[model samples]
Target chain A: MDIVIYGTVNSIVFALIAVGFTLVYGVSRIPNFAHGSIYVLVGFLTWSFVNDLRMNYALAILLSLTIAAVVGFIMYRFILIRLRGMATSEIIASFAVSLVILEGLRMQGIGGFKGFIGPFYVLRPFIEGKMNIWGVFVDFQRLIIIGGGIAVVGLLWLFTHHTKMGLSLRAIAQDERAAMMLGVNSDRTAMISLSIGSALAGLAAVIILPLGSVTAEAGYKVLIYALAVSIIGGLGSWAGAVLASFVIGFAMKISTAMFGAVWESVVLVGTIILILLFKPSGLLGKQKELEERV
Target chain B: MSMLEVSSLMVFYENALAINNVDLRCQKGEITGVFGANSAGKSTLMYTISGIILDIEKKERMRGGERVTVLGSIYYEGADIIFMETSDRAKKGIILCPERRRIFPESSVLENLKIGGILATRAQAKKTLDYVFTMFSPLKGLKKREGGFLSGGEQQMLAIGRALMAQPKLLLLDEPLLGLSPMMEEILVRAIEDINETTGITILISEQYARPILPIIHHGYVLENGVSVLEGTSQELMDNPDVKSAYFGI
Candidate 1:
């Protein structure tokens, strides 16, 4: 019962982190390498708003997510727009932007040698309560993550299927040129994709960050985890990303329970390598490059 | 005014001319056929008219690959629209049903039609969608089917229906009958005729086979090696022995 409950929570967290990256890749074929930095930036932004400015938690969360969306929009419109269609340049440019944002925040740390942020830099959870179910106890935040994550995925599916703009975005994902012929503007679609992707990253940050303290280094760890799930599931495959999250989520939780905390990363990295060696396209991926050569 | 006019249009991919000083016109409420064999620039001309060539040229240049040059003048509704962006061109009622029926593979038939209806107002989309269903009845039962799994003829029908959903004043059908059986070809030809006659939407259809398309087209241009070798009405082309043997497999 414990493994089932915690493993589900782990899987939800992983899916939330990876969904943003997979979406941008699916629509525009550009891996937004700045995903983790955006994730951490939102955590920090909300933290400062709530702690330093002494704002309401709900207000701060709203402000941080909106800012993240705008930041994503600007990143695509100004920088990534010119670099479109060149995957290598896109990766490099996003990585550079991410590094600058993260390192710039670190430099804002209190003094010279010591960083400004420490484990003490944390955001209070929204509910501020705990729940127990069937002989296992978990916080309200964990329950929200589980429930909220599934809701997000379901809502996204409905949006893409039933809404005009969402349908256009999916059209752009499938065939950019065809969409263009049908009057779907590529630039506008890509910009919107970036905006939504950024907001999603921020949303995940807000939901998951309360479980742990915010740190500059956490950005790197988040990026690695997101990338690991994406690669293991198959890049740009949405359903694959969700399903792979569950796989890795359970694996990591079981490993931690069996060996120790140190074995978690080892298992994560090991799973990625094994997947790459055997099925590089991932479990649910139908990416163009991974199309069978024969 | 003609629905579309092209004059002195030439396209080049690094000195290899794909289209050479070609001029074509599709009258309002008429069907025009451009018949050509492989590498005869049928697809290129279609792309150029739909303004997709501009995009292709830009992408190639950005990637430091082939340098594409397009020299052309296209007049629509008595105005020069030679250098417009593709989506803008589409918004102006010039929609292209691309070669190989480039349907969105992952989307279902209904979703694909909705995407194609991006340019229209809600009412127009609804009207056009209903009209499409009536015209291509095969698509009615396959609303939930993904495009990737559709047969070639079914995809062609979906492609045409999708373009119609955009509420086009002029539709460019590129290789609509490609890889279809004889019966499928007949169905599409009749459907294309019906669409043009009933709706009065100007159509510019390109095909490799002249036999199936020749009778329906009011005007036809026979292209060879990127050059228009013969231009005549249907009856005149039927009387031309060279065209009969070359294109009609006489």
Candidate 2:
């Protein structure tokens, strides 16, 4: 009972972190290596605005998310655009940006005198309490994480289905040249994708950071978690990412329960390797059947 | 005035000329057909007119793969539009229905239509969708079917309908009859006529098989080895001995 409850919560948290990466990769075929940095950056920015500046919490969240989205837009416009078709260069450039931001936040005096490092960078949760679910005592933050994660996924589906901009993004993801023929500009679509992806990261950070103290190093950990889930589910498939999150979440939790806490990372790496070996396309990668038929 | 005019247009892929100095014109509210055998630059000509060649050129340049060069100009509605972006050109109502029926394989038929209708107003989309369903009733039954699962003929119908959803003034159909049955070809040819006659959208069709297309097109250009060797009215091409032996297969 405890395993199921905790596992579901862990899975939702993973989905939140990975949804941004999945979205960007799906639309533009860019891995968005700066995703984690944007997450941590927004986390610290929201923290500073709420704590140091003593601004309204909701307003600070809105401002920080907007800034994160703009940063993503700038990243694409300035850096990623040059290396658009080169896969290796895209990975390198985005990773460099991530490293710069993460390390910069580690230094003293940007958001605080001591910077965004150490245990001092904790964020207060929206609500501080506990609730019993399935005979397991879980905090309100975990509940919010689960609820918010599902909401985000559902809203994303509706956006892609009903809205013109979102449909254009979907079209670009499917066939860029074909979409362009129908008046969908790939560059503009990619720009919007980056902004939405970054904003999603900011949203994930805001919700998830409250459960633990925010740290610069957490960026790498978040990136790995996002990659792991995306790979396990299948890169660029939304449903795949969510399902893989649940699978890995439970696998990691069950391993921890049986073996020890040290086995968490071991399970993550092991599951990734196993999935790659068996299903190289990550269970839903582009559906090769279509190519085979052609 | 012509809806689209291309004069002395040449495209080279890394020194290999794909389209050797070609001049083509599609008058307003007419179906202009460009017929050729494979490798005759029919697709290249359509791409160049629809501005897809620019995208190809950019991609090739970025990848350091092929060097694509385009010379001369294309005029649409009396304005020089040789270098317009493909999407901007599409916004100006020049939509390409693309080769291979490049439908989104994972997306459903309805979703594919919705995606193609991105540039249209809500009312235009609604009206076009109804018209598409009325014309291609097979699509209505396959609304929930994934695009890849559809047969070649059904995919072609969907491709044409999807293009129509964009409300194009000039519709470029590239090899729409490829890999389809004779019956399916007849249905599509009839639909093409209906679209041009009813909606009055100008069409530029490129095909290797000129049998069905020649009778329907008002004006036709026969391309051989990247060059326009013979061009005249449909009846003139039918009477031309060279076109008769090569394309008519008569």
Candidate 3:
């Protein structure tokens, strides 16, 4: 009962972290390395607004997410647009942006601004209480993560499947030239994708950061967790990302419960290696099938 | 005035001329065919006119792959569109049904058509959707199937149907009858003639094997080694000894 409840919560958390990363990759073919930095930035920004500026908590969240989205738009328009097609440069450039944002947050004593360094920054949960489910004690924050995860996925599906804007994005994702031939602008779609992706990262941070304190160090960890889920699931495969999240979530939780907490990272890395050795494409990754067929 | 006019068009990929000094025109509400074998620049001419070559040139330049150069003026609806972006050109109703049927493989047939309708108004999209269904009746039954799974003929139909959803004013069909059975080719040729007759959309079609589309074209140009070697009405092209021996398999 404990494994089932905690495992599900853990999987939803992974989904929340990686969905943004996967979405950006899916649409723009950009592995947004700054995803984690944006997540952490939102957390710290929200904390600063609420604690330092004495703003209302809900208002702070809205501001932080908006800033995060704007950051994404600027990142694509100014910096990344010049280096669009070259994959290695994209990775290096985005990772450089990630380093600047993450390290800049940890900078000390600049212009009377103390850096966001320690575990003092934490977001208050929407509701504070514990609920018993099948003899397992799960907090309201975890419940919120589950609900948020389902909502995000469902809304995204509807957006891509039903709406005109979303259909344009998907058209660009599937075949860029074909989409352009049909009048869908690739650059515009890619720009929209980056903004939506960053907003999603901000949303995840606001929901998940409430469970524990927000720290600059958590940025790197969140990035690695997101990478792990994407790699195990297959890069750019949304359904694969969700399934791989459950796999890693259960593996980590079961290992921590039985063997010890030390085995958690070991299991995560081991699973990635095993999947790479056997099925390198990830379980549900079919990105290249269409190309080969054509 | 012609609906589309290309004059002195020359395209070079790293000084290897793909299209050289080719001038063509598509009169409004007439089917214009450019017939050539492979490497005769049929696709390049189509790409140049639709402004897809600009995109290809940009991608090649970005990747440091090939240096593509285009020197020409493409006048569409009385405006010089030589430097216009492909999507902008598409918005102006210069839609291309690309060679080999580049449908969105993962999307359902209906979704592919809907994506093609991104630039269309709701009423326009609705009317065109019904028109596409009626014209390509096979697509109506395969609405939910993914495009990649369709057979070659069905894929070609979907590609043409998908292009029609964009409400093209000057439809460019690049080798529309490539790799299909005789029956399928006959159906598409009839469909192309029907579309041109009923909708009055000016069509610019390119084909290597000219026998199938020759009967439907109002005027035709024969290309050889990146140059427009001969041009006349369909009757003249059919009567030309060189064309009959080379393209008509006489």
lDDT tens readout by residue for model 3, A101-215: 9999988888977777656777899999999888888899999999999998889889989999999988988889989999988888999999999999999999999999988
Ranking by lDDT: 2, 3, 1
Model 2 ranges off by over 4 Å: A109-114, A286-294
Please give the DockQ score of every candidate, comma-separated.
0.87, 0.91, 0.87
Model 3 chain A: worst 10 consecutive residues (lDDT sum):
A284-293
Worst 10-residue lDDT window for candidate 2 chain B reads B241-250
Candidate 2 structure quality by residue, lDDT tens digits, A198-278: 999999999999988889888999988988888888889999999999989999999999999999998999999998898
Which candidate leads in lDDT?
Answer: 2
Model 2: fraction of native contacts: 0.92
Considering only chain B, what TM-score does candidate 1 achieve?
A: 0.98
Q: Write the per-residue lDDT of candidate 2 for residues B1-250, one digit (tens) a residue.
A: 8989999999998989889899999999999999999999999998998899998988888998899999998999999899999999999999999999999888999999999899899999999999999999989999999998999999999999999999999999999999999999999999999999999999999999999999999999989889999999999989999988987677
Candidate 3 structure lDDT: 0.92
lDDT of 1: 0.91
- Each candidate's lDDT (Cα)? 0.91, 0.92, 0.92
Q: Which stretches of candidate 3 lie over 4 Å from their true place?
A: A289-294
Cα lDDT tens digits, model 1, B38-137, are 9999999999999999899989998999999999799988888889999999999999999999999989999899999888889998999999998889
Question: Could you tell me the lDDT of residue B137 within candidate 3?
Answer: 98
Please give, as one word, the docking class of candidate 1: high
TM-score of model number 1: 0.97
